[model samples]
Target chain A: MSEKFSLSIEDLHVSYQLSGSAGKNKIARAVDGVSLQLHPGETLALVGESGSGKTSIANAVMRLLEPTSGKILLDGVDLVPLQGSELRAMRRNFQMIFQDPFESLDPRQRVIETVMEPLEIHGIGENQEQRRDLALAALAQAGLRPAADIGDRFTHQLSGGQRQRVAIASAIILKPSLIIADEPVSMLDVSLRAGILRVMADLRDQLGVSYLFITHDLSLAWMFADRIAVIYLGRIVEEASAVDLIENPMHPYTKALVSVIPVPEAIEGASRTILSGEIPSPSSIPSGCRFHPRCPLFRELGEPEKCLNEDPLLQISAKSESHLVACFFSDPSKGDTQ
Target chain B: MSLLEIRDLHVSYPNRKGEFFAVDGVDLTIEQGEFVGLAGESGCGKTTLALSIPQLLPEHSRIAAGSISFNGVDTTALNEEGLRAIRWKEISVIFQGALNALNPVQTIGSQIQEPIRIHDESVSKKEAQDRTLELLEAVGIPSHRASDFPHQFSGGMRQRVMIAMALSCMPKLVIADEPITALDVMTQAQILDLLRSLCDKYKLSMLLISHDLSVLAQTCDRVAVMYAGKVAEQGPTSRVFGSVGAQHPYTQRLLRAYPNIRHERKFIDGIPGYPPDLSTLQVGCRFADRCDVALSRCATEVPDLIDIGGNQSVACHLVSENQVGVQ
Candidate 1:
């Protein structure tokens, strides 16, 4: 059990029983033995490509899906044992903002109504007028100036950035201690992404809420996140602070991800390690190391038998700078960068 | 003559409010074997400009003014049949989300060979097959995998198949509209590298359209920024996006909004306004409402693109005034 943490996921394993194949006994482990912690007012980014089980972890923590095993603790309280009405009550302590705001928000509802519905469900205000005032305040905090006038418009009437802000206002109206944002700004254009991310960061400071920010972009994580965790095949291969991970990536997968980030300058002769293949299907994971099939480091070492046979657990790096890695060859000083 | 040239091009679509000129008096040029990037936010008309070059405009849209010339031939005057004759063998397009447009029931090999065989009646079956295999290899896909169906391949592989098909006819110019927008970063880098190498090998010109300026900066030789259906700025990628920096306010703000790992991390406000509506009345400047530095005359008088030395052109009143003062 963790002490005084906002959210702690211990040895989380989320698996699904595959249907119509392998005698109905085959199970696909979407999130296999993942552990993470978020302090109060902290932002931890789970970075990976598609099918890396970051979504599964988020869904499990939000209790949208039941995990196969392991405990999810919120403020030192285990969430796995709650049931029925108790589970519904526990949802008030946490909130979620999905990737696509258009799909998440209803077109028929007005912007103010959408933000007020959460307060009504949670019974936060004494009456309708009070709830409207609270909703307006949240909208103003979300950078929607003259919040009352903007709230009168329908969701369809607002721009993409404004719609995302409305969604954030709804998520933060309940004043949840923890928030889960799953690719929240990926749908918006590059120019509009900063506005949405800035609103989310500001909300954290004012409300003292912890954030579980999940994204596939390393640059966004490095720019916004306090800590970065590299997720590969449902496991954390590397974990470190944002500056530490981007400046000194030890894991081979993390190095490949950091190298592929496009800079806004015309950098000449800058070579990026293009991973050979896409992330393997979660259903048919590789034998030992999930990333060995497409890893450049594994092939560079002449296909070591240990990589093919022995699964490496997440361990501290050789330097032991609070940086964690699950790789046999992870010396940034040696310049594992290719 | 240049590979593709547009002179005062104007494109408009009918709306309830009025006629929306999506592309308004824009001019650009692409030489043979050059990689050009067209960037802007959504509804900024970069996609419209890219789609119009190959005469792939929607049925509702019309060419209101100006002309599009391909290799000294006026494409605007070409009939549908004449345009068909010029397509594929001369100008091909790789559209966005085209990976999902792959034929599900057909083998990728036959799909690549279809263009080669249809465009040339004299080519034999074996020649078409050989060309298909060669294109697959050029795009870094193994020849044997060509027999696989679209469902069997991943998203990146299916994109590679689309590229192979686009080059099957050996077109002189290929227009890729947001080619790698949906792929992961690693896959995007691989596809970008593949496109660069393939363009060099085939000696063809490319017009890559995307909303991400960082992507355009890295992949394009020259970058053009669009706003409110007009080209705000365009120049060599190094001068426009590099340390020398873009002269236009829209381009400068767009570059500032992007997240770059190479630079110090700081929170950005991201151009504090909505994208301009295309249906609004034609004015001096479409981006004037959102621009931070705007003159009083910007709302009344239109500013045309002026070439300010160093192969750069900007359509801003302040820039032109500064240029006059410098002279």
Candidate 2:
């Protein structure tokens, strides 16, 4: 709806150089020429399985790991060229939430100190007491009740959900423009997931902050994200609105991903597609269609020549012209009813 | 007689504060070849109940009350040697993160063979090797990869090996605790299907423990919801997890906690508050504090699991009161 995007990733490539023996290749293309955009205040979900380079894309945007090539633009400004102090200065605008709160939080620090650390790092407050006040405000925004009491407790004293709320408090302390949440609820209990998600939603509504929510669960994406991008083998196989993508998945991998989601309802005879093999190691990615080996549609079509010989670039789907897909034989009407 | 029956079981572990009754009065039964699921949040004593089956609890923890009968044998009264003999032979346990429990120094084949050889010492080395390969094939792994070390296998494959080892001695009942929690969704489906097929093919009774309802809904014939060491609800999967059949407040909330791909998008809030402390276990239902529609009597007296209708059991004062109102 707006001309300027909150986060625009352009032809991003992140590859890791391999040492010693690893098949015939010496380099692993973790993320290869992927592009995406997140509008301000919109939640865009990056849906992919392990080793699909979803985290690599997040790390690259955060400059936790330098991209192999291409531009990571923040509000139309290229972040790839920014160095030391500039990158550090730019970091206050964008924050990251990790899957495990234990990994991002310090064990020795009190909850308030951890939340205040961000303000201290950015030099936002004039005094220590002022920073503590700001930290308590952020904690309250994160839905931590009795903010002062919660702030006085150490990280180890809190429950799993409380610990993650503290992590959210720290990430939101500086009122960042963009927050990249990587599998934020994957490590939490199923019941606790919705509460944390609700907290994030309330924050989004209040702060008008954009979220790049990365997760492996499609159902969560369907419930939370406005747009969903399906990634496979370091490439975007499909991208569309959440309802459109789930209702009419063009890519075979996306179809399979949707099929295997076990619904707890007593719906009889819900058929599922379990992909046969694990994702290929990044160093030895298949040419043409990277998902050919596991694509049910490709095999059902008697192994199309185009899928084996020539690569399929991300293009508009035949069914929904607006939907992007990277499969040569993605049919329009093949989405599973289950 | 059922294949496995646990009657009013209570397990306790002593701590600095007091005696922590991790598993308080739980009763469950599994018919021969029945697939049962136990689900709850962490520290809800689902794991404690599963471990008590094979007498796998640590030395300090003791079964304070109740009996666990397997194939008509009283497992609780058995000594260590007797328990060891019955463990892999009659009741094997597939632990959570059991994949990492594999010995990295040994080959996969050798690890599987260890259980087979130990159970049947009279068998020859060749016989044990043949059985190992057969078990591997049963679990969808190629026999040739038997020589591969644990490091060579993927997470799913390592889990498959654990399953294969669990079946090495032809155990009648298998207790898998959160078997697929560490796996991705696709791989988790594969493993669950494999276990389902294996259970059917061998006529083996299985007790699948997981915090997730959907995982159990797809595989288990019956599911039991636990809360703070008590069986909140237990019934057929269709009746317990269906759109409108869940009765207990805890079970109802737990059922909707997961995000279902087919279900319509709606605002779902988690059950508020934390699980009650086991060491300070008190009167009334453990879920009373978190329950939204809890009656005043719910906090004062514990309700027994009553058969409401259609073989469904619920431990809630609300359901009992409704039944009373109807009468």
Against the true structure, whose lDDT is highest? 2
lDDT of 2 by residue, A1-338 (tens): 34889999989999988886644447899999899999999999999988999999999999989999999989878999999999889989899999998777888999999999988888999999999999999999888989999999999898778889998998998888899999998898877888999999999999999999999989889889999999998999999999888988878999999988877866678878899889988888997889999988888988878889788888876677768888776754534311
Candidate 1 stretches greater than 4 Å from native: A20-25, A332-338
Q: How close to the true structure is residue B33 of candidate 2, measured as C-alpha lDDT?
A: 94
Predicted model with the maximum TM-score: 2
Off by over 4 Å in 2: A23-25, A333-338, B325-327
Best by DockQ: 1
Per residue, candidate 2 scores C-alpha lDDT tens digits across B1-327 of 999999999999999986888999999999999999999989899999999999999889999999999999989999989998999999999998888999999999999999888887988899999999999999999999999999998999999999999999999999999999888878998999999999999999999999988888888999999999999999998887675478998887886787666767765668777788878848898889888999999899999999888778999999988988988
TM-score of chain A of each: 0.94, 0.95
Clashing pairs in 1: none
Q: How many steric overlaps are in each model, in order? A: 0, 0
TM-score of chain B of each: 0.97, 0.97
Interface RMSD to the true structure, each candidate? 1.3, 1.5
Q: DockQ (Cα-based) per candidate?
A: 0.76, 0.71
